[model samples]
Target: MPLPHLLRRRAPRSGARRTARRLAVTVPLVSLAGVLALTGCANRERDAAPGAGTSTTASSAAQTAAFPVQVTVPGTDHAVTVERRPERIVSLAPSSTESLFAIGAGEQVVAVDNQSNYPEQAPRTDLSGYTPNIEAITGYNPDLVIASNDTEQLVASLEKVKVPVLLLPSPHNLDELYAEVTALGKATGHLTEAEDLVRTMRSDIDKIVKDTPKPAKQLTYYHELDPQLYSATSRTFIGQIYGLFGLVNVADAAGGTGDYPQLSPEHVINANPDLVFLADTKCCGQDAAAVAARPGWQSVTAVRDNGVVALNDDIASRWGPRVVDLVRTVSDAVTRTAQQG
Candidate 1:
């Protein structure tokens, strides 16, 4: 689920010139949110209680809403059938684990991959670690398995063993994110709830679109992946946030690497972004402004104006329920900067 793995580095420590620009960096825990949890035998409630209720029909609606389906994920040969609502579930990705928890199915999740720490409860649950331990997962006796792009092999074996697996294709942008959330919600028999969340999320996005203070000029921004000045591609999710606010990513015009591409200070100096967004606060000793203050950055427009904005690493990145906050934060940054401009 680590769809984005930009190298982690230190950010610039210097503030930049005044400009209306915004950058969004989701939490560092996001990747753990991506490919996090795993499972084991000891913690399975089904095993603890003999003959646990296998009532596929927890209710008439649940039974009807849940059933078998063949879902084809990206980079896979064929669609696979998911037998039911997955009374016992295993999450092989941190994002999938976070997604399940967001939809209220955390209890149904018997295990998760390693690194899924945000929902600390997930780690506390039985875990098979980063990789799949078929025996351990089998011991927990999960009805369904959720696998990220990297874990397709595990999914294959689970399929051979007759265990249903949900192949979760990694999302590239916000639209795909909406689709994944809706898909997972439906798969989990929480379609209505998921749809409702989508509606609310869209509403938040719409407000950002509408209420965004019209700037007289398109402000330029740079999203630092780490302490390093490496920038995100224009096609990336975080890059799209700047676009949504009608701001410019200097890298966009320069043609970003379409991924987090580390660049020389000379590159940033030439791009001359008006705003600098750091991926984190100083809490962990990672500072964005300091990066801008490095020897060659002194002349950049952003460095002169104090336009460096530190963001919450998690909320800024995730496309889940917290996306509302992403839009809000972006909109606020845009509006705040626009007013000052």
Candidate 2:
């Protein structure tokens, strides 16, 4: 699980509030046993172009997982010698379900994670690791079970089942995200399509960077996950989006490596950002005003200037086709400043 690091360098302090807001809402709505589900809440684009099996040798792991799934996704990495293609698949995470859907195998997903709610047509299967529903998952007679990793109960439950289980690592950044897409594509006999999609995503991003204003300032932002709000570190997907827009994320002050770091009231007051974007409002639970009235948040530009923006939880957390929307949202937030300049 040695993941690559990718995020902005200097994140805003006050914006750290955004993290809690996001996790609070998204985790419950999409959490598959305390871990965030891919919720199919796409941001509109991924960095890779929208093509699968397009070009460039995939990874050693990618080669090993070579298409036309045989048995099941090995619980281990790159253990691709399965017995058959996953015709009846059950997803334990929303993102895992969404990944299958993205590769044109939506019909194959017989059952979905409890939180899965994208495409508006996923089956209402009673599958969730929260309650340990092995019978429910097995009831679908699935050949493959795509479950989230790092869940003890979920992992243990899958091993007991005779079916093949593909344990996908939770995505921490862009490369991992792409890897997930590619791996899932191979399993579904859609590597070629996945490759194409990734390529198209990259091309689109290149265009965004080439066409957008490139003043050294980048965009300065404060992203909140909740009303009390924690912010993302310089190495998270949300943080990376700000980087893609050349926006300076001020959360780095409180952000850690893998996710948004918790911010103290003192820290929020000290490193106020230009704009504030709150993620996943469900976590706020009627706490925005109360959180807003807290000691030092009022001093931050987002609070004072009323620049705080509540984001769409579905599109912001999923990292699906909608990743571009997140970028666009960030772009618009920063564009306001560009216009004033």
Candidate 3:
């Protein structure tokens, strides 16, 4: 129901033209009910290292000295060469903005889109990722532009002006997430810091999964993407995180091919999931009580047993440094529900 969610559900198309299709829709895109079932389409480079539970310390100064780096855009063979360490970077992707800040490239970022709400100190601008404006973005005089998609022929247009652009899409899993972070490191000449951050994130996530208690029976959950009952199946990035705790996704039983599917109220009630994780608290004001109050929802196992977990919408949506926080939140919910059972 929020503007951010509408922006996230981009209309199906190629390149920046997708943004045009999205804006052309006369009616509002609410609850994804009007949109087609869409999965995350971005890709990341291969991981820098193999081990998932290892830790590494990095020297930022030493890494910054390495310049003229070339990074291949994920999902594409196109390689972008950064001639020097970028000093005035413009980030249009929220996840990339968070990754840039986490990998110690924060000082190099001159501006970010309006949606990059984390890190408190991000140089937030009115630049729109959904319907990007080349003139407005170029106004920042960016040496480099980072984006999630090629919305509006952003890459081609930037190339015309000779400004380097890095397109890192939303990753489908943790490995891909790591690769994106690593790629950002190379692009910004902070490869060591990016690799270090990835190692820590892997170690932290592994620990969280290991620390969670196995419930008496396999737990089933419904990940609420919106109050309209749009949910994520286990095939999704969010679902994979839940799967790490051995929790089953109820949406998987709905028999849809898309990672995201809109379910009817009766279907969710019939599934009777053991856990309900609401990612719509901010977007739609949904919480444990809000879910429980739904007609016939009182009969749901999660509602009756207080197994509803409220999640930060942004953290749940983005796969960046804070994904460790998302894992910990799921870990806490799993622990509490296991204990209750």
Candidate 4:
């Protein structure tokens, strides 16, 4: 099975260390894999406001005013100066593509990496974000390029060609995510729409947390990244999402070294968490039945009591607007489990 980019390990970099202090609340330093996962993307556009098209001129002006703006990207020391509103943009990361479209900058995007399949209308290209080819990327003549990971070579090559590159790494928390969305808006001359998008997302997520009653007792959950028992700890962005519902991560005690840790089947069975969330439904073809079929896993409380939640690999992995959908799904599951008990 193709390893989900979210789970793949990446080389350590200076940016990871720079963000460490700001992310003190999160456990384990953010790894390239953790950053990659938080920054991936998939389909489904958020509903736009009525008459949204009517404000194009006004929105563009506001974006221009905000332009010649110098914004520092998260997880890096480099600051990007947007000399003017970008007219032609290329997105190398799926999350970046999704954000551009969500904030009404879709029309500005000239091309997107091969992995950006979301919205069904993104100008998909053969460009590889993993092995960025400056030649193919520059061929589009993009005035601006947005990416997740800032590999030195990739940035240097793009800069050498005079293309401005903005690195938006995986956010350590919700605040960083909001900042990223705002930054994208400023870059694309869609600041008004981006602010609206962020506001709506915050309101929706807040409502979900407020309305969803916490379990009578703490519920233990096992979030499966893959079928092999690799899981995210509470310190991870995904783990933080689960944390909102007061769900205790069983992998927190697995003594794993990093944000993404591979747990042993025996260790999981021993814990027998109350709920199991499978983020690999699409990638690994894992479902409640498949999990139940694993030896000794049949006895796990979540498996025996029908508490397995199959999630869309994309929504579960990406830290984009669809995160509301992921949280809502988890809230519903927790509510059901709480009521059942």
Candidate 5:
């Protein structure tokens, strides 16, 4: 999902910078051993269908450790102490909304931002996560607020009123994703459930990778963030998922600033990626035909071979439980491409 225009265009304040630095110090990087463990679990699950035998057990011991848990909110200097399991929660970001629901914290979610349109039962209100109103948010009397970005103004406003906020920025990699999920679980008294969810996601994603056959030659891919030619780099979380399949990112050479960079149409034509994954199918109405009709895009291999994959804009953009579904969709596309060869 593209960030709300307000967040994407606004410059970060000094306080936000300091908060980001604190997160860097507090959250340890995932170890190689941990990665291997996840991979091992994934391989086992691959032998069965994904989600067929998944377990959902919350350890009694873990529930005891949930309260009064103090965690350094990622991208914030302030460590929030959850005095008790939050009963009235507000999700400012769509990803956070999905995470809360996935970990069985949905019942505690009193309300969610306007952009949180998933799960069919989330309390969607007119609240704007991007341009949050302190008065409107406080009206709900939420004990906890979860958000993706920590804009200085928004954070200060909520803190002023004594509402605990968990600022979880878009994760750079899968390890960071796990940490975020774990933190949310501990904060909401769902630590065991969160751990289980993470394990399942890891297993399912790895299964997709394991089942996908390596192409005869390295495949080049273009992931379209919008019809305007914006794209994610190999270093971004979205790119890392595609990287798992050994697909080279065509946008890497653009050297675009930030995670997302806009590419010129001509540059994309010159690269001529083997596969095109359109994350803007819903947002921009882009499809294989739409891409082929673009001036100078008819010659692209992906278009010519009908290898353009239309994706759910929300799933592609949000780093949440449904990320596994995105991986499965991409894996299927890759399998088809390899078979055609």
Candidate 6:
């Protein structure tokens, strides 16, 4: 699902660098695996999936070790331990929810935040990741809760009730994203499946980057978060994906302090990016035509050459398995632009 209308354009709550790193952007389909050797993101030694010829004793030991897994929360020194495989999991972060379902832990999810609308089968509830209600959450009797933030002292509150919470924040890069997947897998006892998913994702993304045609003249782009011209810079996570294709982000030169910067229409027109990626299709009803109709935007190079791309809000907003799809979409657009040139 698209971010809540009010939050669709809000910057991150942290410092400038982190703030700039979190803006939603167009996702690519057919995703990446640049480094497969990262056993687990939290520094835990991962045992390989038992071979078919492995002894039963070894397999049993592997299964035993899968539990009592400990994962360091992303961007923090503190770690949370999953004492046992979580049977009743409640996910408050949409990205984490998607990761759980993708890693084969769907059946273990007892409930998910309302924003976790993908997978369709996720037990969608009225629970809010933002401003969570302690009573409503504890009522579900969840063994584990995964959220993006500790909003309203949620972690402390849950701890008071003896419920374990895993804080998986928005990743700063692909490596961090993979680590989150690894962490979730370990926490849920699906480490092997998670490793497999990471390998596939890495392989797919690497292929997409290598196969896409690189334009002779490097293409420049503008990633629109909304009609108001809020944009993501090259320093952001989505920006790194664009960097894979050698696309330049005009927002970087717009003199904004963070990853998600609100650019003046004048700066965009002056930069006149070769491509305009709209991430507000679902939230704000924007499209190529709407962009062309904007005051002075018709003169933008992207508009004149039909280079405006409308991205799926949900896919663009979440960094998960579907990132491969987002990558594919960008690849197709880059191919078209190169062909036109």
* Top-TM-score structure, candidate number: 4
Off by over 4 Å in 1: 1-60, 63-65, 72-78, 123-136, 253-258, 280-284
> What residue runs in model 2 are displaced by over 4 Å at the alpha carbon?
1-80, 129-131, 153-156, 215-218, 255-258, 282-298
Task: Give the runs in model 3 whose Cα sits over 4 Å from its true position.
Answer: 1-61, 73-75
* C-alpha RMSD of each candidate structure in angstroms: 8.6, 8.5, 8.9, 6.8, 8.1, 6.5
The TM-score between candidate 3 and the true structure equals 0.83
Q: TM-score of every model?
A: 0.75, 0.73, 0.83, 0.85, 0.82, 0.84
lDDT of 3 by residue, 1-341 (tens): 11112223322333323322221211011111000001110111212353421322234455556777889856556678888889999998777787788776887899988777766788998898867999999999999999877888999999999899998766656887788888999999778768877887888889888989999999999887667676766666677888789998888888766556678899999999998987767756789989888999999999999899987766677767777777888888889988987
Model 3 lDDT on a 0 to 1 scale: 0.71
Model 4, CA-based lDDT? 0.71
Residue 324 of model 1: what lDDT? 59
- In candidate 2 the C-alpha lDDT for residue 238 amounts to 61
Please give, for residues 145-210, the per-residue lDDT of candidate 1 as tens digits: 776543427766777778877766545566666676666666666555456556756676787679
Top lDDT model = 6
Model 5 poorest ten-residue lDDT run: 24-33
The sequence of per-residue lDDT tens digits that candidate 5 reaches over residues 1-341 is 12211111122223334222212211111001122233233233334454543442235345745578887745446567778778999988777777787777887899998877766688999887766888999999999998776654777888888888887777767766778888888888878767987987888778879989988888999987666676767776778878888999898888745456668898899999999987656545778989999999999999998889997666676666766776777788889889989
Ranking by TM-score: 4, 6, 3, 5, 1, 2
Whole-model lDDT per candidate: 0.56, 0.55, 0.71, 0.71, 0.70, 0.72
lDDT score, candidate 4, position 60: 73
Give the worst 10-residue stretch by lDDT in candidate 3: 33-42
Q: Candidate 6: list runs displaced more than 4 Å.
A: 1-65
